[model samples]
Target: MSDNRTWRARLIATSAPAAVIWIRVYVGVVFLTEGILKFTRPDTLGAGRFDKAGIPAPGFFAPVDGVFEIVCGALILAGLVTRLAVVPMIVDMVGALLITKLPIVWGDAPLFARESGFGDFLHEARLDFAQLCGSVFLLLVGAGSWSVDARLTATARSAASH
Candidate 1:
């Protein structure tokens, strides 16, 4: 009983404003779409692009990243374990900035991410930066009032009181 309460206590600890659902929705859709596009448009977004970026083992890593994005995006959309779900996405974005955007900023542009100047880097990196920030926000907040986490926490609290 005591152990269960401890677990429930941790679960019940999260509280967030409903506004965060907006961030979750945006982040989730973007990630999910990017993942699906990796499969549907492989030449542009998946292994081919990775190859152009000189990523090692492009075929293996791209698909793995796609699957990771899909699963994590779905979890974020459903507001389930959002804090945990966003961790992979955070890693994903950081890797993206390093692999794709940083090269552009350094003027050694990848095949697809070629840019004329630092301005191009800023423009191209905007989306990646936004998604990275959104993932961080979700990680900090742990979903919001309109989430599975909230419902589950509420349920846990009720059950505990009984």
Candidate 2:
């Protein structure tokens, strides 16, 4: 029994770093895809949606948000400056939840779902909340042992020890 527990622990330790990488990749892909879609389908998830949501300066903020998402997502995917990259994504998700999704939950139906019920509101906001939580996790935990940050830290340590 003890031997089985030891093996399980070893397996978990070995796989943990890979799990972080997977999380990074998953979140990065989501941000990247949404960013690209913002530009490619501007009338849907871009300025149009912003305008409908009553977000001020939708025309300017839409592209700006897209650029931030693309750049930050790319950085996170590369595991370079991932902590820094996720900051903006965290802020973005918070803004989305507050400015857009929360209102749906609170009774103000979104433009796309004015007829949707409270259950629909929860369903629609689920992804936003998940992304928010995921970004927070990445921000707190960083890129992990398999990342470029790990390599950089190792290099710095090696150099300092010399």
Candidate 3:
């Protein structure tokens, strides 16, 4: 029984890093996709969407936001400085939720489908919250074992020793 418990503990210890890597990859991919979509057609999500959402200074803010998303998304996908890369995304999501999903807008009463009810809005909010959670996790945990940054850091440390 002790041996079984020890083995289980070891397995969990080993697998924890793998889980972080998996989450990072998934989160990175999603962020990259969103960034690409935003970057490719800034106008699509530019002042237009912000205006509809009633965010102030959309014209000034949209381009900056687009660039941050694109660059950070690429960095996350490449696993280069993963934690640092995701910081901007975490901030961006928080800003978006605050500006776009405020009480009044949320009270718009059709969060998802145009004709959907309050339940739909809650569902959409939940999904958005999940996305925010994923982003925050990546920002905190980083790219893990599969990352180029890890390899580079290890290499640098080894070279320094010699």
Candidate 4:
């Protein structure tokens, strides 16, 4: 259908700078590693942490969240549907900020975490902020010339012109 084509075109099209790769690499690596850590460091970042943070259904959401990070991280790293990949990441980061970091801002750090002041909140949330910014940037800019999305877009344009 035309709607599907329109969505595909939007997802693949790109005019981003090549330097965008650096941002993608950083964000992708951080997410990929963090996802792996959820399994490897359950007591600190997986269900245990979610439980301590007062998230409902910690057992189910932890692994699901980790899986989304892992899959979306790889997708962004490969520059395939970069914008679409980052959408979920943006949501995830915001959710993390609200559920985990907001408490620190309110002077009541979650059980697994600790914070007494805004400075501590900043210290604890630097990475989350960075990741959120990076994801938002990618969402606005699209994948760059060096990306798989760019190549596919070029190919599609070429075919359409013929």
Candidate 5:
């Protein structure tokens, strides 16, 4: 029983890193899709949306935000420099929540609606909150054992020991 328990523990510990790949892939795809949509449907999520949202310099900032999302998303998807890639994404989500979502929660009218209750606001902002938390998690845990960062680290360690 003791030996069996020890093997089970080892298996669980070794398998934990596999979970990060799913998180990384899901978050990366979401960010990437958002960026692509901003470019493909500029009127909906790009400058037009920014203008409606009252973001200053919408023309300049909208495309800039899209570019950041694209680049960071790509980096994360490749599992290269994932920790660094998530920083910009984290900032983007926070900015999105603060600028767009919180107003509705605080009794300010939503852009499309005359008014929104807190429950509605919470429902709307759920994705933003999830993305924000996911980004923070990746920032802390990094790309994990199956990633380019891990390969690089292993190479460096091997070289150092030689």
Candidate 6:
């Protein structure tokens, strides 16, 4: 029984890295899609949404934000220095929470007012928080065992020894 338990524990420990990698990959994909959408439709997303959302420096920051998202998202998906890549995303989400979420939570009146009150702000805040949490998780946990970084590192180490 002890042997079986030990074997089961080892199996779970070994598989944990794979599970983390899978989660990172999927989350990266989500960010990538969002980045792509923003990149392609900067005017609608960049100008219109930010302007409506009351993001500061809307004119200049919007395009910059879109580009940053695209680049970071792509890097995250590729698992190329994933933790490094996510740093910018973390900052961006922080900016989002500050610029957009705070205003919604505490600001007077809805800027767009399709519906009044803080509901929209709360929703946006929730989304931003979720994304931030995901990115942070990737940052702390890393790209995981199955990622390109891991494979590349392993290959490089093998080559060096030879």
Against the true structure, whose lDDT is highest?
Answer: 4
**Model 2 misplacement above 4 A:** 1-16, 115-118
Clashes of each: 0, 0, 0, 0, 0, 0
**Best candidate (score: TM-score):** 4
The sequence of per-residue lDDT tens digits that candidate 4 reaches over residues 22-140 is: 99999999998889989999889899999988899998999999998999999999999999999999999999987888788778876625465678778888899999999999999
Query: Could you give candidate 1's per-residue lDDT for residues 99-128 as a string of tens digits?
Result: 888778678876634475788888888999
The whole-model C-alpha lDDT of candidate 1 against the native structure comes to 0.86
Better of 1 and 5 by TM-score: 1
Ranking by TM-score: 4, 1, 5, 2, 6, 3
- Considering summed lDDT, which 10 consecutive residues are worst modelled in model 4? 109-118
List the candidate 6 regions with Cα displacement exceeding 4 Å: 1-16, 107-122
> What do the candidate models score in CA lDDT, each in turn?
0.86, 0.77, 0.61, 0.89, 0.78, 0.67
* lDDT string, candidate 5, 24-137, tens digits: 888899898898888898888998888888899988988999999888888888777887889899999999888887788667744646557788778878888888888888
Estimate the overall C-alpha local distance difference test score of candidate 4: 0.89
* Model 2 residue 59 distance off true place after TM-score fit, in angstroms: 0.9
Q: Which ranges of candidate 5 are over 4 A from the true structure? A: 1-16
RMSD of each: 2.3, 8.3, 8.2, 2.3, 7.9, 8.1
Q: What TM-score quantifies how close candidate 5 is to the native fold?
A: 0.86
What tens digits encode model 6's per-residue C-alpha lDDT throughout 1-162?
A: 233344322222221275676656666776777766665776677766677776667778777777777777777776667777788888988887776566655554344344334677777577678779888887777776776666665665466568
Model 3 per-residue lDDT tens digits across residues 1-162: 233344322211221264576666666676667666665665666656665666678776777777777777777667677767777787877776666554434455222226344565455556456657877776556566667666665565466568
Could you tell which candidate, 5 or 6, scores higher by TM-score? 5
Stretches of model 4 off by over 4 angstroms after superposition: 1-5, 111-113
Candidate 1 has which clashing residue pairs, if any? none
